[model samples]
Target: MQGGVMRRRLRRRFGLGCLLVGIALVVAQSAAAEPRRLEVELSQLFDRLDSGFSNWQGQRLEFQSARPGDPTWYGAATHDRRYGVEDEGVSLGAAVPLGADWVLQPEAGHTFDADFLPRWYADLRLQRRLSHGLVGALSLRRTEYQASRVDRLALGMERYWGPWRAGYTLNVSDVSTAGTPVGHALALDHYYGERSVIGLRASLGREEEGLPGGEAITSEVTAVALRGRHWWHPEWALSWELGTLSQGDLYDRHGVQLGIRHAF
Candidate 1:
């Protein structure tokens, strides 16, 4: 009888232990089903910014279509076309993260135009996040244009405040025909809710023209862009953007773009 009693006691302890283990597993599975705190997105854009008047009363257009993907690593391909002119180009780029706080981006492109020789260009960029709200970047670009070559370096900084973000870019460039010039740009961006954003950007720069003794010219470019997006499900979204660009002695150009994106 004592042996039977001890056997029942052992069986009870074993079953109780299994019951506790099953409850713990249920709790772990519930926790695992919760949403993640971080998010990653990939997107593509088609942009058209144009302004100019010609002797033939034609408008100049710069259109670009690009497919870009972003994760821990990123990549992009872009095709650029000019209207009323036989000029077009394509670019491919990639970005990789080096460590916790730094990223490296490298890009290359080729351009073909009737007025200019086939040109090749390459760029490299380094970026780091300084804090929760601040980021900094440095970039360099080299291009071979016709009989001349151009090299440029740029520095940029950005700050994020709540839903509003602001940034600046400074650039210096050396052209084989026109020496060197410095340029500056400023921009402001606002995010509305989770799926809408608006931005205004302006840039003032000095560029060298390789004609009539290659003089330097000052130019200002201004733009305003608004974008809206709607999420149909967890992995799908519909997006729209409207933008305008204006410059001196140039006709203002306006554009509208719409697309759908899916995340995996």
Candidate 2:
């Protein structure tokens, strides 16, 4: 990863991990409690950042507590070192019901002594359950760097039918220096026994790039991944991903991530 693209790739990795967790939890049956309102998860990822910059890696710990059909509080703390610079960040957020089958999620985060990652970040999303197992959502995100800013908007749809879920999303991003670029993502997941799931996701899109010397450009990027989760015990679950990404001809990379989640 190089310069600005590094942040974008990092964001994608985190997003992919969260995606698997979210989808899995939606169908998970804890067997400990009716809802298992309180939960904690620990995860790590290893990536081989090419081009001799540095290897990218991180560990994350997150917690959430909430009851069904009620307001939820969640937070995360992360320690990451990429490009040979170490940074730590924390974020707090909530999921609140807005009536009429609508839901809202808002979060804010800040990185301490940041060099590669954004110094400040915020996101807001609104979603509603539609007819016949369909849901629609819209989201906006902002990331502030030392001397740059990026804003993104996304529209998404998800459908669940007979042990299968499918989703699609379109994202448009605007960089202060680089131009706006659009990306599309699609996913499919199948569930068995309420706690085990397997999924595949693919994304292809254009990304805004600001090179080392204030050179702004747009680049094509594509990624594909297989992710899954299974419950080994009533209160414990395991999740994993294997993925590859390519950005034009700059670099080709493969990575793996694993996580464990528990309810208390």
Candidate 3:
């Protein structure tokens, strides 16, 4: 993860994580945002990026075994780029809950960039129920990306109003490439029925970078998405998302995702 590629990888992971959470919540039962019993999930996402200079296509696959408030393990594979000099990799990780309000996740993987590089990451989060319809979370995360590393701190809050739920997240990251990046995300969801939901999400960010010879560059990123999920039976659910991204004014991308989950 050197220079521009590092930033790209970080952004991709950010968007994917958010999409997964949104989908799970939408497909959840009326009383919970995730399956309370043993569950398995599979997901796929595809994106195309156009930067007026080059075109990049990305595809990702994820599989997970989950049990709410317990331990969960996941595996993911990502392929991004059309040319031979693309980024492709696989990751494996696990999340374990500590007590009622804390979760710790650790992951290790490898990526085949110019060569093969080892990657590892860890996340620790604390979530609390604030009031009748409010919840808040604070988290810290670190990623060791080949030659570069990133450290991030984030805060998030969610509020429930009637059939609607809204959330906001703010984060700052210390990137090994360029400098630091600051971002915020907003999400709004409406539960149409007991087992169906629709959601809208948007995110914005600014990253500062330092070039050779003391030059500086500022990168801006924006993402917007629409998603929905429904449970057709007590044990099966489906989710989908469509999204677009803009990196500065020259780069733009569009993506689609689909997922299925089953509880036993």
TM-score for each candidate, following the candidate numbering: 0.59, 0.83, 0.70
lDDT of 1 by residue, 1-264 (tens): 000000000100010000111111111122333332222223333344454432111111111111111212222222322333433455454444454456566766665552332366788877776765666878898866666677889998777667666778798988776667777767665655443445555555654322121122323445555554455675565555565655434445555555554544
Kindly list the per-residue Cα lDDT of model 2 for residues 177-259, writing each as its tens digit: 66798989888877766456777888889865433322335578788989876767866878677888776666666778787
Error of 1 at 39 (Å): 14
- Ranking the candidates on TM-score from highest down gives 2, 3, 1
Candidate 3 residues 1-264, lDDT tens each?
Answer: 000000012225333343222222222223335453544555566667665434445565655565444456666677655322466777766555555444455555555552222255566655554555666777788765545666789899877667777889898888776578898888787766554677788989974332222223447978898877666886787867788877676567787877776657
In order of listing, the candidates' clash counts read 0, 0, 0
In candidate 1, residue 173 scores what lDDT? 87
lDDT of each: 0.44, 0.66, 0.58
Better of 2 and 3 by TM-score: 2
Candidate with more favorable, higher TM-score: 1 or 3 = 3
TM-score, cand. 2: 0.83
Top-lDDT candidate index: 2
